[model samples]
Target: MQLTSTIQKLHERAPRLGKALSLATATGVITGNSIGASIPIWFMGAAKTITGAKIADDTVIKVTNYWINSNNALIDNILPNKDWRINLPDDVHSKGKYLLISNHQSWVDTSIVQYVSEKRLPLTRFFTKFELIYIPVIGQAFYFLDFPMMRRHSKEAVAKNPALQGKDIEEAKRACALLKSKPFTLLNYLEGTRFTKAKHTKQQSPYSHLLKPRAGGLALAINALGEDIDGILDMTIVYPDG
Candidate 1:
């Protein structure tokens, strides 16, 4: 009873505590990840200066993976009980290239996925709306890392400009090409958005845990990078206690 009461009190005060923890962790991860990411650039720069040859894709991946692993370690230490899990095949690490098709249930899902994949797998990058690219630090990083940002248009706009209809698809292909040139994991959430009670009731979702999977995004990914992908990483995340 006392424990329950204490937990209730913590819940009541969770917002403030969560905000502080998130800020502190974010500061540490961003700073660490930035420095970590720069190490590879530095190495490549020195290699180019000394050897007069561009760093190989495999070598760049190894260097970046080191930083990503360090970032994941920091994340794991901070959120030990966050209920994040990565479900991939036994040969997944051996086959570093993957297409992770997952169901989105919360805003936290991406962070959880990235946190889990940091070092264990390759860096998980996503296709996002172009507007996100204008968002200061995030945009800069996305641009630097060649993250795909699509400009979504209305039906009328597409109808008027037929050329624009397939632009997003083309952009996705380009992004996949960049990943294929190296070794990386592509993260695709088939559900599109987090599952909410309102959305669930609207869609009449078949599963208690997930909505009906959307195929367009996943299809585009498979079609564009099908040959390069080692296999599908079908991940399912469950948070039993909300």
Candidate 2:
């Protein structure tokens, strides 16, 4: 009798659940495409070539800011949610150079962060894997926009090949040096990966709220690009409920 009652309740809710899931998926896809891969290939490519990219000149800064503003408008039109908000300091300026740190939770976190902070900060860029540079359109766009593509060497890999130890950091520094012309934000996720219960249990992490923080990327950014930084933005994003 109890099993039959549970089945009836699930059957009643199935359609509602399915509809909700479908809407969520559609919303995600629209938001992602509106701001991301939908962007044209030659837009930034032409800008880079025209300016010679020797510096973040007037044209480069203008185009970059325009792209960010257009994306923000698209996000507002599509995902108008009151749940997402950012509390930036009163003195935060769009032209200020920032080292931003945040917790990694979902793939969607990047879009959320960019949308919220876009007005108060420069268009944020993260260090991407060096291999992403070869992926055609998106990779070329990232390069033109001054995103640093880094080649990280793990401890085990570095141990066996001593010559590879600091090469990655050196390469990142060389890339970042070109970004001195304009103020920008460099974002890093301290935990390095999204949280999972199974992985958490295996690692036996100490914190109830966060995974263990990794220092490699943070260290390299601070050490290599420290001199130009104006302020550090430590943003803590908390979800409702546990």
Candidate 3:
């Protein structure tokens, strides 16, 4: 009776104690995912260059599955109170090419999306800022993963050079060509960033759980790779506590 009473008191004082430990566990899982993220990038080029025969697609698939599974496990740990789910179709294997769009709620949203699409679908690749390419090992890994990088210019600079109009699209096309032989999923966050109370109030967003969706990025993606892609996978992620 005494031990049980003490346990109850501790639980009462820190209702979220378990959840906090779970978050730490989730952070560890993401660290594993980050390490897994580097493996393919580390070996693919060196192996291919050494052997003169391109590495088999199966090997790449295995490494990506490890990364995605670790990521999903991380999501499961941190969001224990929430009921998480994934909607996967029967044609996952054949549905190689996809343009995946999702609503972004928090920083965790990207990992959740990647975890959901990793194996059952295809590798999740997205466009990132060109500056991220200089971010030490991770940037080089992104380069290996063939994640597209772009440098955004000021309006005045663009006005000075109208020829830059189609440059972004051209870059996307080049990235698309690099992954043509293998199946892959292209991920795009429709909101483009984490939703905050400040942003929600500023935008006057209609959705209770999301900020206003930007159409330009989606439109650009559709225009560039719409023909090759099977369909758009619309994903929504919600965090009740937030």
In order of appearance, the predictions have TM-scores of 0.73, 0.74, 0.74
CA lDDT of every candidate: 0.69, 0.71, 0.68
Write model 1 residue lDDT over 1-242, tens digit each, in one string: 45334444554579577546656866878687776666665556456445745354345445656665676665544442345444655676734788888878888788678766654677777888888867744554564455667778889999998888878878877776766665667888888888888888899988887777888877887888878888888887777787
- For model 3, residues 103-134, the per-residue Cα lDDT tens digits are 77677677777666654777788878778878
Scored by lDDT, the top model is: 2
Worst 10 residues of 2 by lDDT: 73-82
At residue 150, give the lDDT of candidate 3: 66
Query: What value does the lDDT take at residue 160 in candidate 1?
Result: 92
Ranking by lDDT: 2, 1, 3
Kindly indicate the candidate among 1 and 3 with the higher TM-score: 3
